[model samples]
Target chain A: MYERTIDDTVTTFGVSGKLWRDSMIMYDRATESLWSHITGECFRGAHEGAKLAVVPSTQTTWAEWRTHHPGSRILFKPGGKGEGSHYRRYFDDPARFGIHGRGIDDDRLAGKDLVLGVRFGDDRVAYPIAAFGDASVRNDSIAGVPVVLIYMKESEAVHVYERTADEKTVHFEPVIAENGLLMRDRETGSLWNPARGEGIEGPRAGNRLERIPATKIFWFAWQTFYPRSRIGGID
Target chain B: MTGTAVLFTLLLQASAPFERSQEVLMGDTLYSVLPLDAIPAIDEPQFVPVAVADTFLAPTEMIIGVSIDGDDRAYSAWQLDEHEIVNDVVGGVPIAVTW
Candidate 1:
């Protein structure tokens, strides 16, 4: 997700049907500039060198999201047939599609493994979904910035946050409560909804964790762009 | 140089290196590359506001939820699979949802 504006002009974008490094390229109607969907940067045309601001988002099941946000709205195509996922076959057996030609040289993880990738400056870290399994929270640092990564099985959503609040560093542990899995900060014992990045209970109630924008994507696609990214859960 | 010329020069300086031929630009080998406009990007997709309960999608279906300011909205992956893009506004923020 990206804010579609270039030089104060609010623009609308569409798929250019172009691919760069196995990612979709977008083009703006205002300038016809081509943008990399992954990086949100324009690579061609009059608006080349422009970049769209990244917005933090989550990819999860409808049931989980609806349960958490009862009043939230959903996207749908009226009178449209539910053909199911277009990439279901590709996701089930990624190797069959061979989207990445000749395969990736790095064998750190399988090409099709899903990962949550976070970047700070030039440093990047990837959390493999397979490693987290169900609900888990990891308090770690990237490029010296203390961060927390939370994974929820029910929603299959990963959220990243800066764990500092009120100038105090907070540590988190995964706890199962009436509301399901939540991150409980050790210092203040505050229960946080990682997806919403909000402190729901304890001394730090009402405080919101600073979200770190991240992407949940395939290892092959991420590695193709961020080859030097560190894999979390690896020594 | 005029202000517009200066801005253009600066933008060009910051832009990524461009290939002389559009073919070379679209000839990436890492993935199965498609011809330019082969998939056809959706330029003007429509979005309507509706209550969550009113939605007809399955419970397991995926959606990309975006919250800007205090407004929150979701873009169905099923719809995106067909259109590939949607330009919409949330809380006065113009956003592009690309699948």
Candidate 2:
């Protein structure tokens, strides 16, 4: 039972019309992604094809979402037999964090907005901005465990771990640049460079070694209290 | 007979200080948290039930010293005051108490 104060209007790629769920309410931050009993279509709740997006910060009223979307269309009807018709079933689905209802005037979302853009002037660079769960819930088989997913300016989704544990994945894409290298331990400022013969340790010790050129580098490592889950998945 | 007398004298020597409290000692029983010689024992939750105050008294201090599931650490008590029992699943474990 985690409590979070939400105050931003979440804008999405395929959503339109007045924002039904007001942003100024305190909601349980559960289910990071939009989900649906429907197969193909998606919504703001935890479901496939639906990604976490930032809510708009400043706005006098809920009608402002119309201005952001402009040409976006929303299908209010129920889901059809198959294909795109399933999209309509998501109309009334609650947002992943238990945010719902209307007529609640909230001031917190009055100006909180999410800024999406390409980083380092590269079109290939897509900074993951939103994720529903963090690491604690990611590795667990349980459906929900305070998921702590995160998105960086130029990386994929990540799970946030509560405590460093055994067999848990500590996923991070460390970017190393020319004249500067990515460090494994951020606090200690340790550099990871293949050209400099900085040997990789732990699970992926003898795998395909890449040189950490002083450019953009992204590397991932999993932290486990016990070293049971080896590379290529636990047997 | 001489060995028996010596043993009696040793018992008398050892029981001198506990003699007065020996009446109260009838109700008290020593409980060991771990087996006779278990290594790498946990020092937390320093309470264990060796005897029942009454026949209806259930064992409340039952805690796992170590893993029963390869490397999982858990306690029989919910520890709900600490609020850590929200999203865990134990299939066939016995339930002494539910917070």
Candidate 3:
């Protein structure tokens, strides 16, 4: 869900086959430090307390990604036999999946409901997928900073961007274009692609919206790590 | 070799067993979460380039798309599911793609 670059070196990482609070722990080879996959922070080893830099990334379907980045390269298993998914059953019935330990329960949302969580400074906000029903753009603010959350149903991808550009506040509304859902700024009518976070046309052309790193994860998992996070729809 | 030389070599090997200091300062007990090398981390992963249309991945498959310095790349979750780690370079930036 995040780029894996630690310090100046792009350290290689591997799954430690370990879990802390039901989250995956990754180990970097360069320093042998253990990191939480969700937080991307080194919790153990010589690089303890070191954090990997956050790179804005999108989790989208292959078709949607290909539509935008046709020339992009994709990873393929060298000798993969097409075994489907190891988490197929887990995804099918996420609610029934038992989580170990106790004192980590939060019934704010269904344990399996998917949420796009963003953290700015000490403020954390979670936007449930259900809140965006048919709308692709949700203009809102986090910690008093104007932000826009964009959701695409076709690929089930979500992106968050700062709504301010050139010291001016900008609001975005969803417009169904030939390609897919495109955002139009209310101020200058500039069209923006939510996926790329760039203004494609109009007065704001060449302007890029700053993206906030977010994670698309289950509500329970998000809450477990970020108990103080605000649920967008709830409060 | 001579018996005396062979005995000395054996003693040297016995004295220098392959052991790394297990001291770790983190709160969590060392190896308490999982033993070292339990999942076998990928040191250096292999990457092959192919046309986007020939990726052979399902349309709904999830990917981690990263664009840095104008060079973009996508790491397939399915492929990462198998190896759990990939060390790659793109646009002069080194990155580790992990599932």
| Top TM-score model | 1
The TM-score obtained by chain A of candidate 3 when compared with the true chain A: 0.63
TM-score of each prediction: 0.53, 0.17, 0.51
**Deviating ranges (above 4 Å) for candidate 3:** A1-10, A83-112, A116-216, A219-235, B1-33, B40-43, B46-55
lDDT score of residue B51 within candidate 1: 55
Cα lDDT for residue A34, candidate 1: 81
Model 1 off-target regions past 4 Å? Answer: A83-112, A116-216, A219-233, B1-32, B35-55
Off by over 4 Å in 2: A1-104, A111-149, A154-158, A166-235, B1-99
TM-score of 3: 0.51
- List clashing residue pairs in candidate 1: none
As a whole number from 0 to 100, the lDDT of residue A34 in candidate 2 is 25
Tell me how each candidate scores on DockQ against the true complex: 0.24, 0.01, 0.19
Number of clashes recorded per candidate: 0, 41, 0
**Ten-residue region with minimum lDDT total, candidate 3 chain B:** B1-10
Order the candidates by lDDT, highest first.
1, 3, 2
Candidates by TM-score, descending order: 1, 3, 2
lDDT of 2 by residue, A134-156 (tens): 22111211122211122222222
For residue A115, model 2's alpha carbon misses the true position, in angstroms, by 11
Between 1 and 2, whose DockQ is larger? 1
